[model samples]
Target: MVEKSKELKEKEQKILSNKTQSIYALALLIGFCIVINIIFSFVNFKIDLTEEKRFTLTPSTVQMLNGLKDNIYVEVLLEGQFPAGFKRLQESTKDLLDQFRSESPYVQYRFFDPLALVTVAEKNNRIKDLAEDGIKPTNLRVMEENESTEKIIYPVAVVKFGSKSIPVNLLENSIAGFSDEEVLNQSINLLEYKIADAINKILRVQKPTIAITKGHGESKPIETQDLINTLSPFYNLKWISLDSMYTVPDDIKLIIMPNPSVKFDEKAKFVLDQFVMKGGDVMFLINRLKIDMDSLRNVRAEYVPIENDVNLEDMFFKYGVRIQPNLILDLECSKIPLVVGKLGTGAQTELFKWYYAPLLSSNSINPIVKNIDRVNAYWTSTVDTIKTKTDIKKTVLLSSSQYSRVQFAPVRINFEILRYDPDPSKFNKPNQPVAVLLEGKFPSLYENRVSPDMLKTLTDIKAEYKSSGDEAKILVVSYGKLINNLYNPTQSDYMPMGYNTFEKQLYGNKDFVINAIEYMFDEKGILAARAKEVKLRLLDTVKIKNERSFWQFINVLLPISLLGLGALFFNILRKRKFAS
Candidate 1:
């Protein structure tokens, strides 16, 4: 028995020795393989950790990925140095593209130093194309040395995924420089749209519908030209004047009422109410009070205290909105050029120009206007409390700054009118509603049961006190301009200034109007159609190169190498249990 025990111990010792040898062999094999891969690997194996789940993609991102027939390659075009924000932009894009590459086996990326590759740099036009698309870069970084400053041009990032190639210009167009974060975020935001477009090119689908209400003195389809331009790219557009000439279309998703100058008759009102009762979303751009900015010379423009505005008071009250007859005046008015030095030189004198226009900033950070910049409005009205009976959620989308007040329109204020005589205390206040979004259940206008004859009586149905037990509605707030572009706050020496051009000519107002309409419609995901600035991203080549090399060499690569070495040593020790 004792001899057998000794033999068993010896056998156990032999097994341990064999196992150790096997481990050493395995380690040597792995090390050899790793070295071989490092030497032979043409593309760096970059990993993505942004999202937990892999193989799944958002609709737009997937669409964009599928848009690649061949491999779509992205070139990071930077020169000596990138902008401050571009580094963050590059990291985020790297993370996204790394994930994108994982999902799309063909997608690839490359970094091009435009400065190093001068011949290749000047010839590239993708950066300029991106600017045309709207992704402008961040601010420029002027490098100063020996009392001399030279602007370092940053190169653009280029992407060629499959047959489709996208070049993101960063350094040029001095207004925007190295805005990779802005570009990447907008790209992520519009992931679905890009996907949709790519898929549609690869796979065709019906475009969504967008409708504007007519027949009730709403803006004509032609009048909403600017709005249509902004929307048509994303939707199949239509018009319904509601003039009793034709019935409303079945697929009419959104009904926009922009400054309906004529009152709705019994039938027209019914049409509007029925559309709402059926749970259709509505955006009302009613003129709370008729306004015409006082002319610069007159110093006293027409002022009429609106006794009643287009008979919308009661209708608005029902929806928990107070479309006050007062006007919103921001201490921050849009600067307008006046004819100075007797109107010839065009020296361009500017004043707190009220073109019924308010150049206000953004108030709420909702998804609709989350990354959107400041919004400018013209001849806008003040919107008051949105009071609903039960369980209605309300959000004030836009508001006037603390230094804002209102006066009953027609405003007596004028261009010649400089500052108030005393302290301009009344102008500055906390928060004043310029635009609001109300969501939730709304009381039905026909809750008590509609009379067949009353339905026929489209004109003059004054059912003010009637209450609907339980139907919900959404009420959007806006002054008249959201619907039309009729007013121009200027004068060419008694010529009576006007915008003969169109509503679309205005800057961001047209977009704001259309977006608000989609928010109200809230169907078929129309709002998700286009990215805010997804078309292109322009980066400064000079700044980007300097930044990328500086950051990665100093911050990223160094830290990672140290960490990796430490990990390797720790692992070796861990394997050797009792090693000193």
Candidate 2:
């Protein structure tokens, strides 16, 4: 009886000892966790395990966030049920916004479902209101249990700062020739840029002045309405007639000369030179040749291409680029509707490849054109970089594709050419540059050519005639119609720039122009965010389909089997321990 009592006391002591050890371990773990939490609370940082480091924001973005003076509110409309791809986008957006909030107290965001818990009439009214606010809805076909249902979603965000607000399209639908998943990945890559840019525009205190040169047969306000609308939020735009003004206004930091038809006089050229000398940037959208599509109103109509005598040749050569009076014909071109046959009283029309309107693309990874869609160019000319004495960094931003050929001026353009297919053998020329970006100090066009009277006028105006310009940037595009928006008579409104009505496609013209101006004006590296790339990691559907059953079986049985074996081992161990 004493031996049994001693054994019972021994077992009780062992149980008490095990309980004490477990309590100590629990206390230590809790203390360690508290210390870790305390340290992390003071030092906030995240560990991005992604191979691409996609979650890491660019330094420019961080700097912009740090300099925020006012609160930025973002209302993301991409809420509620979605496919796996869209859900990934939604999660990424939340993660990015959380990171933004962590960096700055001024950043705030919320997710909202416009149609959630609403009646049919209310949902329709909500969608209409969103549309009026420029937040268009995207129709999605969702698959559920082998049945497909249509779902409408608003994949956009409204960013507001103070009284100003702008809608940001979260999905990049302009990308072509990419899979849906890849497009979504690209859209995710651009979210930071789009959101940050909108916020920057809204919070901008001081805006630079941009002058649109008039009296040079440039595009009218109606033609370039979209461009003006796009830039008005960021810059102060004014029409400056070169013929009337003695010189470009002192406040004008940039000059956009759009498609000047008439030749520029020597006096006008002098003003432009002095403007460049004063460290002002310039974007010259020059068309060396004229090919009017309006002249081709009837079937088999023709128009002869002629040299547009804008007379900026010497100026361009001095600036390190020469726009040749030739037209680029590319195999990769946009289609135009043509009368193919007569259908009773009405004319039957068919879409034909219009080689003259070359769809311009860039292989260079320049920030202005990187990851952007093709720029639509009408009667584009070729640009060649001249070997100049000044150290000018000339970068080609847009070029024709591999199957392209250039026709010199006076080439006949007719509807008859569209009837026959273009021969590939003839289109041997490739990568002909259509746009060139020059960055350096430029010599004045009127350095020695300026008359004494002009020099006196410059001196009288208190404008120093600088023989060589200060460091500046000049973007020369051979196609002038790049910024022109089509006017629809029936709608009585101008179409958006880069929009093709027939093809229902939006080109990169608007983005390209904006990016070019932004690149020139960007003192900070904020525009660099546009070049961010997120790698696409997609599952192999074929492999999953083949091994679905195998994986399912292993996933179901492995855990149960392990649990059963563990229980059996524990029972054996317990029995052995008690077996005295």
lDDT of 2 by residue, 170-266 (tens): 9987476888888888889888888887877777678989999888789988899888887886799999877776788888999999999988887
Instruction: Provide the lDDT at 226 for model 2.
Output: 89
TM-score of each: 0.62, 0.89
Candidate No. with top lDDT: 2
Model 2, global lDDT: 0.88
User: Cα lDDT for residue 101, model 1?
Assistant: 74
- TM-score of candidate 1 against the unseen true structure: 0.62
- Whole-model Cα lDDT per candidate? 0.55, 0.88
Q: What is every candidate's alpha-carbon RMSD to the true fold?
A: 9.8, 3.3
Model 2 segments beyond 4 Å from truth? 1-22, 117-129, 141-151, 296-302, 448-451, 489-491, 542-580
The TM-score of candidate 2 is 0.89
